[model samples]
Target chain A: MKAEFAHYKKEELMRMLTIMQTIRTFEEKAGMMYGLRKIGGFCHLYTGQEAVAAGAISSLDLSKDYVVTAYRDHGHALACGMDPKKAMAELFGKVTGCSHGKGGSMHLFDVEHHFFGGNGIVGAQIPVAAGVAFAQQYQGSDGVTLCFFGDGAFHQGAVHETFNLGKIWDLPIVFIIENNQWGMGTNWKKVSAVDDFSVTAGAYGMKGSSCNGLDVLDVRATIEKAVAEARLGRPSLVEARTYRYKGHSMSDPQKYRTREEIDEYRKRDAIQSFRSRLSEEKILSEEEWSALTQRINTQIEEAVAFAEESPEPALSELYTDIYA
Target chain B: MAEMTYREALNRALDEEMARDDRVFLIGEEVGEYDGAYKVSRGLLSKYGPKRVRDTPISELGFTGLGVGAAIAGLRPVVEWMTHNFALLALDQVVNNAAKLRQMSGGQLSVPIVFRGPNGPAEFLAAQHSQALGSYWMHVPGLKVVAPATPADAYGLLKSAIRNDNPVVMLEAELMYAWKGEVSEQEFLVPIGKARIAREGVDVTLITYSKPIRVVEEAADRLAEKGVQAEVIDLRSLRPLDEETIVNSVRKTGRCVVVDEAWPLASPGATIAHLVDSRCFDVLDAPVELVSGEDVPMPYNHTLELAAQPSVEKVIAAVAKVLYREDV
Candidate 1:
């Protein structure tokens, strides 16, 4: 982060840092909890990709703007004003969860905050997010839609088709590609014909840019620019160059990447970097930083307790929400 | 009242809706500037301007997905696919996004959009293009599929579909588009999920809709000449299927012949036969008969395409089979 680029208020910077720490802590706990058999089924932790979700959502107004993401969406949901407790309860598949136990870790839904969905299909939410934006534009609302997807989803035909529509309609949509270098087991170089992702946006006649997803400030600035462009009746694309520390999901043994490579990303840990910078700049005192961590940890613990204590939804609930 | 063809009724509906609401728009290939391939969206561009009445590039998937986005954002979009045959390219957006969004969000959002155009076996369109896949959409939980037969129904149904809160797949028959009927000049809306008894009879009920509504009517007229008073029930909607009309009509006549333009095996006809058999078993004097499109890909040849779909002859045969059943 440049000295002159640091225009954010001290309290705001501290708040952003707390969000990063909270995401990191939450994901770390999720990974451990899943490993310890406390959490079951599929869980994809946003361990290394914390800054990407946290930084981008920091610039968003949750009331109007919407979010639709791929399966690696727990962190995105939490950052988009979803209560960490409900999000965790959702992960626990409890009735108190965000989706009332219907959707597990992959499908955390918080409609009140305008979080459209955590879609399970690859590249599926692109058009859905666009539709939400289309409705907003139709109703004369200036609300924008943030559609999140992985590097893997770039190959899908639906994404390209949606990009064309978004461009033609001049929809207020920011397509955030969390290009964490790898699409599950395949590397970007192997799958994508062009090494640079910003070039793909040019195919759809939309402006595209790349930012360091590991740097929270860089992501925040880039998204701020993209969101502004989208609000002006122009859709834009931002390819965040980040990496995931964990395997694709909780079940994987992570045989695809080397331990040394994981260690490399760990050295530039987003949460640690943001926390250290804020603390060193006197934006956050040591006591305040400790208190933020303590609060987040307590919140996670309480969420776990709530999920554990909550009863399962009745058998009839399965048939209740099928239609209007 | 004014006389209007089914296609003209569709165009009039769009013109009226766009006049009423600025948010209402039409988008598809040949819809604008070209005055629509089937001329269903004629004069809409001149009426609503290019922004609302858009003529999209030949990208059904792209434009349909765009319509989904636009609808979610609050636009009332009437997306025509030239014909439903081309909608296959945009099935991802239609099936995955537009249909699933409301329920996927647990009713947080509503897709108040319409994907409208002619469906069913168009002549010589071959396997890829010719299909009565309204049942495919009916298999989806969140969608509402409406197929209107007459010019009056087309006008009323299109008006209602545009105002619907959920995403609607509206089917118009290509052959029946030019057929004319009386339409009211004032505001008119036909309720969805309801059936209209086109003709009344007593001996047997001929259940059908869309393109086959005409087929069954001709069959009923031909049967009337043979002293067979066959009742004709036109199902306007497939999703919230009008089982009541079919069951009651079958109970009165004690026999049914379900005529569908779609293929056999789990089709609308098969499903209707199942419902009638299950609900009105005791009331039925004879087993329900089904007449459907051939259980094969529609051939490209003109005669083969006609043979592929359920003809008036087939419906007549089905009615006769139910009327004088050896098993009964």
Candidate 2:
């Protein structure tokens, strides 16, 4: 861990920790709000999968690169520099929300930051990501697209089709599979023929690799290399073995897994592991850690307050935006 | 005016649009090396090169979604689906993403794309290959649907579709591709959401579009021989339907008959009938009648295929019924 930290500056490492902590805190607050009937529609949390987003996003050139993901995208949005207030407001279905309240939880878009969107359908964003990469290549820009999907989307036909397009055109894109063990209630083993999703990349004649998603350092290093390869006109697939701490959505009864299994994954919690590593390396002190936690808590509380006070979208808004 | 076939007119439109704008490009199966499956994209590869005239594998969902993504990223992409039948595999992108992006993003993004290809029944192609998909696309809110019945309309409507700032689905008739008509050589564009009055009369209004317009024209000629002067209205654009033209024509004629090659149930023809009944009920002297393709998958047998689709005879019968001239 110390050797890996050598490649990153002290401030960069601290920023990564802050992003992970922010995502964890944000998801916790979102879940509580949903229970209170404040946030409606589908709300998929990114509690345990923070390391993957935080690491891969941190490796990109945020000014030009694009990021697109599936519905479990609150973490990806925040890591890509989306305002926490806008995201929370979007979930609250307010006029000030990122999608102007038209798209509730399943869709969050910020064109200024080049965050394409958080699509609702399974594996639907895969081809769109390829298109974004195609545009980048067409415009003669070196910017790459980070396309994130779940282990469940691995079986979808669109994913394989997109892989072929990316390989044949040599589009600049990194397909990141956040394997959170379960696709809602179904396990990957029951749904997929292969044990590793990245292994399927070989069918498209592209490079494939896997890493520990819980280890932010490992994720960042693997993605950094992949991004470089993509910039050189090559596409690659990376499978990040990870887990999810909460149910798939707010209403999920979670009948498929047991308390023992949840407890086992919690033992390797990403935030705890990173916090301990920072503390042991003397990079962050006890007092500094407490201050950081307090700051994040205040920021989240302010976002909730903003969402609570924002107005509902006007009735006329329904007719507008239907056509450009 | 210059004489050209429907296929030539479409190719000219693509060539003109590609020459007009650098952002506009074509992507689809066989759009490049093979020219086109139906030769609608002939000579585009050599003219624009591979970057602009992209040939894709048989991955409809993948390439279609990619077009949507590219559109959102600030490029105008013209995606050819081979035919509307193959487009079913990519309906998720067209319906969920392309149609809903602007509204979902709250005007922050727009997908200026055109999905064009041959549609409706053609020759012996049955079932999956021969389907009229105008109603399917018109049902989607954010999309604009257009079908041209002549070479002039094909060239004008396609040019407009490529320049429009929204997602447009242009359904071309495979059976009418070789049909020729006089089209103006001067640059022009046919505005979307408008209908054309093909013929003038006073007794009955024959409402139709695309390939069915030809059938209705023949039916109108037959009605003329029977001493019934029939007016003909061509609905070039299905969505944003030209209710004004349809209603006005029906009010003048006092009788209406809609001819469509689509299925009878929950189809575009059904919607038009309902609109006429609701909006021009008092003005109509006779109940509206419809002539539609049989409600079944197109059959391979030539005889069954002929019976499954709406024909000139069917249109004439429907017109006679609407005019209360069953004795004819």
Candidate 3:
């Protein structure tokens, strides 16, 4: 833990904390907006797995590197420093949304930030992420890619194909599995044959590691090596053993897991633990903590206002993007 | 212009495009070391090297999706499926990603890729291999589907497909690859979304594309022997159907017969027949007859397979029905 804290400057750590706080605050407001019937379609919240996105992405050069993630992407999108107003407006199905309201909740894209998308398909984005890495390699760019997927995606064929391709071609990419323990009500332990992805990585001759996901510093420490290896064209896998506090989607009934199990993981909640670390390390005062929370709330309020004021996509847009 | 086989024309087109644009590349199974499954990419590996002329494992979905992603990231990839039959395995990448990305991303992404290889029935490659899958991609809105009937069309259409800023599905015929025709030595691009008047007449309009264009021509010749002048139209582009050319031809000729190597239901021929019936209903002298491959999986036996595909006999019969001349 001392070594982990030494790796990042105070400002960088503070930035990551802000990102985690923003993701938590943004999703909580999004859930409330969903209840008010403002946001429609499937909305998967990133309530519990904030540290994985904040930590793993913090280990990269965000200006040059690319990010592609699964459907539960509000956290990754914010962590990439994409405009929260655009993300909220996308969830609200407005013309000002990231994808102009065409991709709601599940598909946010910012070409400028290199946040490829909030791709909604199951296991579909793996090969695409590999392709993005292929372009960077083809162009001889030093940039590496961060590909995030759920534990459920490991069962897909494309994911296996990508693993083989990653090692064979030595693509500059890190495959991060945000194992939140559930595959849409089905437990990963029940469906997955292996307990850890290290066995799968061994089969493909790729490097693998696991991190204590509740601790943001541990995630950062674990993935930093993986990211360095990726720059040398040696792909690696880093599994963040995290857990979600809420049900899978907005309306999932919590029948699969026990409330005690959910309560157990929440005790080591990422934000709460990080708050303690900041206080213990003398990183910030109690008054500063309150100010940070208040600032995040104000940011969330502005995002909500931007979404509500945004208009619906114009009728002429229906056939516009279909061809280009 | 010089005489060349359909395969040579395609090879020349690929060579020219890869040389023309540094971003253009060829990728598929057996495309590099083995010189392509059908020799269409015969010497591309040697000329373009492994980087531009890539070879991949039999994982169609993986490579195809990679090609789409590469195109989205600003490379023009020509993804070849060994055959359109095997492409069925990668339909998810083609439909869900390639076709939907532009609209789904709300114009932030565009897949400038070309998926090309031999399509439609060829000899006794039976059941799975022998099938015309043009209609599968022609149904997609974001995709541009092209079927080349002549060597010039193959050379020109492929060049255009490689240059177009949209995803194109180029359907080449397996049997016609060795068939020789006049082609330009210099670079040329056949405009997409247009029809060619292969042979002009005033009695009946015989419309077809790809491999079935041969049978349609033979049927037109047979009609001419019986003193019935028949016009033949090769619709090279399937997605953006040239309705004006088709409508004008059928209206002027006052009769129509559509031919295709694919099955009838929901096929390209079915769509064309629908177009003619709806648009040129008042000018038609008879119902638009269709000569399509029998609605069944192609068989292994040579005779049964020939019986299944659009043959000269089938085209002649359909043309005779449209001409209303059973005795003639």
Q: Pick the candidate with the highest DockQ.
A: 2
Cα lDDT tens digits for candidate 3, A228-290: 899999999988999998888888988999999988988889999998988888886899889
List model 2 lDDT by residue over A31-135, tens digit each: 999999999879999999999999999999978799999889899999998899999999999999999989878888888888888899999999999999999
The true-versus-predicted C-alpha distance at residue B49 of model 2, in Å, is 0.4
Candidate 1, CAPRI quality class derived from DockQ: medium
Evaluate all candidate structures by whole-model CA lDDT and list the values in order.
0.83, 0.93, 0.89
List candidate 3 segments past 4 Å from native. Answer: none
Every model: Cα RMSD to truth: 2.4, 1.0, 1.4
Q: Which numbered prediction scores highest in lDDT against the true structure?
A: 2
Q: Give residue A24's lDDT in candidate 1 (0 to 100).
A: 77
lDDT for residue A236 in candidate 3, whole number 0-100: 91
Candidate 1, B24-58: lDDT as tens digits: 88988988899999999877778778878888878
Each candidate's number of clashing pairs is 10, 0, 0
Q: Give the runs in model 2 whose Cα sits over 4 Å from its true position.
A: none
Tens-digit per-residue lDDT, B123-208, candidate 2: 89989999998888999999999988999999999999999999999989788999999999998999999999999999988899
Error of 1 at A130 (Å): 2.4
Structure candidate 3, residue pairs in collision: none
Candidate 1 on A108-164: residue-level lDDT in tens?
778788777777778877777877787777667787888999899989887887888
